[model samples]
Target: MSILVFVEQRDARVRSIVREVLGEASRLAAVLGGPVVGVCPAASDPGLATLGDAGAERVLLAAHEAFARYDAAGYTLAVVAAIEAVKPQVVLFGASAMGRDLAPRVAARLGVGLATDCTALAADGGRLTATRPVFAGKAIQKLAFPRVPALASLRPKVFAPAAASGRTATVEPLTVGFDPAAARAKVVRMAAAAGARVDLTEADVIVSGGRGLQDAGNFRLIEELAEALGAAVGASRAVVDAGWRPHSEQVGQTGKTVSPKLYVAVGISGAIQHLAGMSSSRCIVAINKDPEAPIFKVADYGVVGRFEEVVPALIEAVKQLNAQV
Candidate 1:
């Protein structure tokens, strides 16, 4: 059987996470010597054909009025239909909020085992083995499912996105008799956050701040540095709780878990809950005045100085690096 990957989207646009999942799915398919298929719930997206570059041999798009907006129930139904059509041995999803909600429902409907938030995956002898964090990132658990198709959700940014191979793929339309009323939930309207920044989960670089920034006004330093690095802006729970930043920007256990290529923590004391969220980041840089801050312990590099002094210098350095490039 082949491998399948769910294509994630937002506001009539394909999300970067889709590429990440496809990259991983392609590798898993190689291990099993199987083909990779891409599945998406869209309202006639021409971009579906481009999935081939990421390693999909065929792309399936489920188009319907109910798909115009995201309703978990309708989406689940469409995905189930696609899964039944493909009959894949392994199905992969990027562990975004939507994927986290959809994977279990899809698994239950199909009567198969589902693994969530897998950081590592491997296919051995046509069997699937998944490594995931347990006890709030304190322990690791390896899971295997041999009897049925393996449904797994991968952590965002843990796997690098595969480059386009310039191969063309065939696009197929999936017919689903979608009923709008059948969906228990329907999104009426979608509003963006106050200021749109890079998507944290998909960003390669993120600059996160905490209460150490002193006040909301001081966050300018963080923003400036983010702009220099073309990074997303994130916050610790304390910053969110204090109303200095929105919950969307918060990066901690209670907020959003992000594993970017580079994570920069400014004036944030690392709490266990916060570490649980960003500990898997490929490279972590901590900047705080206190040398004893908890964030320094896990940081791949630490700066012992105030963010005000450090941020300006860092921003300038990034500018020079960009100019040289």
Candidate 2:
């Protein structure tokens, strides 16, 4: 048996989540005594080195000029072709925007069942079991795969990157025949978000604000706190829908799921959808005027107060600590 992992890259750089996914694949492969193969679709991506370091026995690069921009249909087709060629028993993806968009497409093309956004995966008795949160994270569901290639998209940060054992794998080119322009969805005009901070998925510490921010201007306080702690700034779905922040900054079931080491939720009553995205954080701090808010149930610490009063004091405390350091 062999495991094939799709290496997710951006800006010609391998995202940290890809390394984590590779580590996860390596562990799964070890348990099943399977070889691990990494796949990257790019014309010239230097991040291939990191994949080799992550314990991939072979890294396959699918070079095409059309891959410069992400096309969901084109990428899915390329992945399907790669899987056919490699004939891996299992496949994995980093449950990011691209993975979320591409995984189902590949599964459908291959006429297989795929477990989406899996928090944990294990193979036993020649079957793959995928564990994922369901019902707004109120329950975790473990399901078995009944397909030729067990397909799963792993949530970012759920698996830690294993140690590099000083082995570099051979890089190979994938032979895929497809037309990029023939894809259904064409990503047009992608504008970068302003003042990019640490990636939310990769951040160890995250300071997130909610509807309690009131307006977009109040987000400056959150940004200030994030900067002081060297953390990423995240928002609840309410704030993102209100246009106070970009969709990328939103953390909820309908948005990006994150599991930072420390999560600070301000002025946001924890909804089930919101908790589904961040309940996996190592430590949670909830600051809300209503002490009975559902967020407190999952939070490690709680502060009952208004954001207008609490945020300034928190900022000052962070600043004082920084100055002392």
For all predicted structures, in order, the TM-scores are: 0.92, 0.89
Deviation from native of the Cα of residue 51 in model 2, angstroms: 2.2
Off by over 4 Å in 1: 193-195
Worst 10 residues of 2 by lDDT: 188-197
For model 2, how does the per-residue alpha-carbon lDDT over 1-325 read when each residue is reduced to its tens digit? Answer: 8999997766666677788888888898888777889888876765575566787888888877777666777677679888988899989998887898899999999998899888899888767899998765668999887778989998877788868867787788887777765666676666875226577876889999998778889889899888888899999999998888999788878876788899999988998889988899999999899989999999999999998888889989989998998
Q: Which candidate is the best by TM-score?
A: 1
| Candidate 2 deviation (Cα RMSD) | 2.6
Report how far off residue 318 is in candidate 1 (Å). Answer: 2.4
